[model samples]
Target: MLLSSAKLALQDAIEASPLPDDPELQRNLSEYFPAPMRQAYKKQIDNHRLRRDIIATDLANRIVNRLGLIHPYELAEEESVGLAEVASAFVAAERLFDVREIWEELDEAAMPEATRLILFDRAASAMRIQMADVLRISNGFRMPSDVVDELGRGVQKLSTGTEKLLADESLVLTTRLQREFASAGAPEKLAAKVTHLFDLDGAVGLADLAKRTEIDPRKLTNAFTILGQDLGLAWAQGTAALMSPSDVWERLLVAGLARDFQQMRLEFLQRLTRRKGMKDNPCETVNAWLDENAGAIRQFRSMITRARAHTPVAPAMLAQIASQARNVLSR
Candidate 1:
């Protein structure tokens, strides 16, 4: 039986007023020659139970650690979702193994291509499914709606075909942010400022952050933008450092194709804007263009999807994509 199911069964057995009869238990006991032999079996059962409890506790701790690592800002807030509750949900879902697998892959300096892809795909799907419950729990804790929404978007990105890439990028960004804030003297204070500025939808102004950090607004702005750029450069360099030339070229090609598709969409919108005044009904013109280019758009999307699927991204490339996403969201 699955661990989750087994856990439930154990709970039910514990709660029963009169424990159910167990023929297997009796048979095992009968095999023993004397009272001493039966005591040996009891000792074995005690050892097994001790081992099982240790494993369960370790898994729960790992789950809490992973959740906090991924959603540091969210968890750091005064009124944030309970990490214990979120960890329980993962345990209930029997997704602790999935979380374990992801952490194993992440901790490795390098992983085999096939194994990395398989792990990413499986973990991404599991995360996507679990995020709804996490968001629900966050809401119950009265986390800011915008903060919860931001967390949702971050999780959504991490649940896509490019999950490995995004995950690596996130790791890099987190590390750099920590280092950067530490250098500013008040690591926690500066981190909260930066988190509020970018992750919290600029809920705190630049001047306010500057005042709190005792840094000039101009310097803060420069540092923020420069850090963002450095994140991209660091990711690209890291990818090159980790992968073969051909592999790197493949990644570049996939990125180029995605960018081209985005540019195509932009041009279409530009055209719509230019023609808006000439059209009698803007909605009709918009619909007509969409209808006319539907096939082409579908083809472009399909090509990008296929390319992404076939091209495996190095773990080091994750930071750049994550930085790009943050930049987009901030805009």
Candidate 2:
């Protein structure tokens, strides 16, 4: 009788309590809240009747379906329990519905426990599916689901074909370069041959870092294509000077090094222009930059020299120094 009376009392309280209609409060609070908070608030408001257990069960079913476990009977009770726990944790974190947020959260530095890792993997899988759908729509590709399969074989094939074409072009260019440079008494270095093609003699040593064997031909093609586009736009606007294809290729190769050595490259270029008093010609500018930055190169070499000098010391201290140097060099 006491339990029955308590249940009746709880039902009466729930029935009496209506949700607060506070649009003004929501608006005011949302002005100060971050995007994730506002999204969570909206989701909770829209689905207040949905219990956490129901959400967890739904998530578990979706996960099993994604994993290709078609029969419900294939999901053992023990496995279902773990899935429910992971889903419950995900829901509690307010990422049950926001697939993008869930994906980003998975990139946190600290390692997650097993349950959270499973949750993250499910989120990542969902994100991949979303991206695939977007790509299909943008590319206007149509394929039967069975033919393409879940791994998107049709898209993979398109990518592989494009890569093969670019690789073949690179091989042709390599053979032509080998013959032409060998005829001209060029040093056997691939960088020297590529640089000498545009009369850029000074940067041959630094260009060695970007080995022809390592760089993709597609990347080089894209770089020159962008340069052409920019030059065309400049010509239309009558702002920048027109450049020959060879001159632009030299500039593009030197510009590519900006990614690995931004500050040094920029300072070197500025100082070179000041010293050489050159304008509107990238080939001349780059050659001058290389000549003027010799001191800076020597300083950089000195830093590496110091880094290589490892004196005998305690094992623990030496290990720490080595690790630190490794991090610096890798950067």
The best candidate in terms of lDDT: 1
Model 2 lDDT on a 0 to 1 scale: 0.30
TM-score against native, each model: 0.23, 0.18
Q: Cα deviation in Å at residue 198, candidate 1?
A: 16
Model 2: residues with Cα > 4 Å off, grouped in runs: 1-268, 271-279, 292-296, 308-331
lDDT of 2 by residue, 1-331 (tens): 6434433433332233221121212332343446776676876643445332233233343334333332112111212222222222222112212332434443442333553344444333333222222222222221222212322322222223332322232334446545654564433543232322222111211122112223232332223222222222111111111111245433233222211132222223333334343334434444443355546545544543443363422233323333332333232
Q: Write the per-residue lDDT of candidate 1 for residues 1-331, one digit (tens) a residue.
A: 3444434433332223111122212322333335666566766643453433334444434443444333322322222334433333344222312244445534452544554344344343334234323433334422223333333333332223321222244355446645654454433532333322112111122223333334433333333333323223323323332343345445444333332222222233334445544123433444455466556545544433443364576433343343343333222
Give the number of the best model, judged by TM-score.
1
Clashing pairs in 1: 165-318, 169-318, 169-319
Per-residue error for 160 in candidate 2, Å, reads 18
lDDT of 1 at 276: 49
